[model samples]
Target: MDILLSICAFILAILGIAGCIVPVLPGTLLSYGGLLCSYFASYSQMSTSALWIWLAVCIAVSLADYFLPAWMTRRFGGSRAGSIGATIGIFVGFFAGPVGIILGPFVGAVIGELVNDRSDFAKALVVGFGSFLSFFVGTGIKLIVAVGILVHVVADIWVHVVADIWPAFWNWLTNLF
Candidate 1:
């Protein structure tokens, strides 16, 4: 049971890391899930306080991810069209790979702004840039939280599993020599 939980935790941690840039996945929440799995494992040394703290951070980051893009768009004078376009771009970009993912929101925002107000190319560009910046900021924060959770899970595994087994494995190796 412990091993199974540990494996699940590792898989979740990896997925959480990928989710940070993928946009469709809830990276921080997935990471928090991983931490929870690890916490439940008998070998885990994680404290209840740490789990609660991580849960708070995950929720906060998730909320920020949802709102940051819209806030940035509005801050840069973008409208609902721009935000909608950015969202569409994210889904569309998913098929185009990394470069597309990176540029999709900006292009979408620009196109949306242009569609909304063709007379103001400069404003559209500003809105597009704002959306682009928001992507980076949001992704950066999510990545940080996800990575932190991964680190914690890994440390727990190392301390409990690897460290415990290392001495025995070393002895076996020495006897075989």
Candidate 2:
């Protein structure tokens, strides 16, 4: 049961990291789930304080991922249309691979701004840049959190499982020789 939980935790942590870039999954939340799994595992040495702290960080990062781009678009003088377009572009861009993921927000914001008001291409570009910048910031934060959780899980597993097994395995190997 402990091994199963640890495996689940590891898988969730990995998915969380991927989710940070994919935009479709809840990256930090998934990481939090991983942390929870570890906490419940008998072999985990994760403290309660650590769990609470990670929970808060996960929620904050998740919320930020949703709102940051729109907030940035507005900050850069973009309208609601630009924000909406950027959100839509994320889903559409997912099908186009990495390049699309990187450019989707900017292009979407620009297109939306142009559609909303064709009089200012320059403004549209600025708004697009803002969305692009937000994507990087949000992804960075999510990645950091996800990776941190993954590391924590891995460390716990190593300490509780591998460290215990290594000595016995070494002895067995020596005996065989």
TM-score, cand. 1 vs. native: 0.86
Residue-level lDDT tens digits of model 2 in 115-177: 999999999999999999999999999999999999988887777657655566678899999
Regions of candidate 1 where Cα sits further than 4 Å from its true position: 164-177
In model 2, the number of clashes is 0
Where does model 2 exceed 4 Å of error?
165-177
C-alpha TM-score for every candidate = 0.86, 0.87
Clash statistics: count for each candidate: 0, 0
Model 2: lDDT of residue 131: 93
Top candidate by lDDT: 2
Model 1 over residues 85-146: C-alpha lDDT tens digits?
A: 87777678778899888988888888888888999999999999998999899999999999
Reference-based TM-score, model 2: 0.87
As for candidate 2, its clashing pairs are: none
- Candidate of highest TM-score: 2
